[model samples]
Structure formats: structure tokens, C-alpha cells
Target: MTYPQDPYGQQQPYGQQPPYGQPYQQPGYGQPGYGYGPAMPPQDQGLAIAALVVSIASLVVCTGLLSVIGVIMGHIAHSKAKRGEAGGQGMALAAIIIGYIGVAIIVGLVLVFVIVGIATDWDFD
Candidate 1:
């Protein structure tokens, strides 16, 4: 800490490198940091989101087909998220629940129809 000290190290000869080597080193070049290892991959959320969308659509479209698709997509999303390859776990769960609900609704309607038809039989002799 002297008054006439040099920050860049003792003055180098004309057109010479400063002491201590290159002033800075690029990262990932074994320079301490700079993504020395595989970069963190972006999470794939398509499955999770698709599951949610299909589940919602099931209520309006083919309750059986769409709901089945939603359930599959949700399972895939959950698997990917578990492997640290995707996001939106909550969305996947919601999709699964909704898909099941859709399936249940369809089943309930069929049962109701059968019950009413049986109850009102004319018993034509």
C-alpha cells in the first residue's frame, strides 16, 4: 500500500505482458467457473401443460378419449419432473384429477340412464 504502487503489477517492458499472466481468463476454459461442466438444461414443461389442456378439453370434447390422453400426459409429466427433466408437477396432478373426474362423469351418466330406463319399463305383455 505505497503511494507509487502499480495495480497492474510492476510496469511491463514496452509491448510486454503484465506480471501474473493474462489479466483475465475466459470461463469454462478450466478457469475456475464458466460452465466447466454440462450446462443446466431447461425444464421441459410441454407434457405437464398438455396434460392440463387435454384434461380441460375432455369436459367439452370426448370425455373418454380426451381424459385418457390427459391421464397419460400427466403421468409422463410426473415422470419427467421426477427425473429432473421437466417442471409443472402441480399442473400434472391437476390434469390427472380432472381427467379422472371426466371419466367419472361419463360413467355416472351411463349408469343414470340405465337406472331410469329400468325403473320405467312398460313390461308389455
Candidate 2:
């Protein structure tokens, strides 16, 4: 009976390891080689993050007064991202959305209070 030859065309006697000087090496698994692909560099996301923070603060503490500033910053950040000058476009968009919602809520509440005040006559004596 003839045994199958190894990759180097050598048929070693049944399960004995190769010589110490010529050890068999296994192929690398699940790891990328050096400089395998192009990597994109990171961009600045300061404006986007600041906008998001300020927008959240407006809703939580400032009663929408700072919402307009947040919205402006968000727009600038979003535009920078669109032009490939920055990152965090999603965050900027969320800031803009939240700020606008805050502004709307403030306006709605003012309108409601005005209507209630007009409907009732209180004597200031």
C-alpha cells in the first residue's frame, strides 16, 4: 500500500513530526495582512456633537431659548458633512430635529396660554 505524499512531495513515515530544522507552518487564519486595503481618515465632529448637546439642554433646561442656536450649529455641521469636511451627519440632523420640535412646543404653549387668558376676564383690583 502507498501513502499520499505531502505538499513538498515528501512521504513521512506515518504520523511522525517533521524534522526540527524544517518545521511545517500553518496558514494564517482570520487576520488581515499589513496594508491590505485603503482606510478612510477620520474627520472633525465637534460642531455636530455640540449641536446635539445644546439641543438636548434646550429641551431639558433652557425652555427652547437655546434651541435656535443648536439648530444653527446643526445646520453648519450637516453642511460640512455633506461637503466631506466633517463627520456625525446623523447627530447634526437629530439636533436640528430636536431643536425645531422644542421651538414648536414653546410656541404652542404660548398660544394656548394667550387663548385661555383672552377667554377669561379677571378684575385686577
Cα error, candidate 1, residue 41 (Å): 2.3
What TM-score should be assigned to candidate 2? 0.67
9-123, model 1: which lDDT tens digit per residue? 4433344434454453332344465757888877778889999999999988857889889988998898888888889888999999999999898888889988987999936
Which regions of candidate 1 deviate over 4 angstroms? Answer: 1-39, 122-125
Who wins the TM-score comparison?
2
Clashing pairs in 1: none
- Return the lDDT, model 2, position 110: 92
lDDT of 1 at 76: 88
- Against the reference, the lDDT scores of all candidates come to 0.79, 0.83
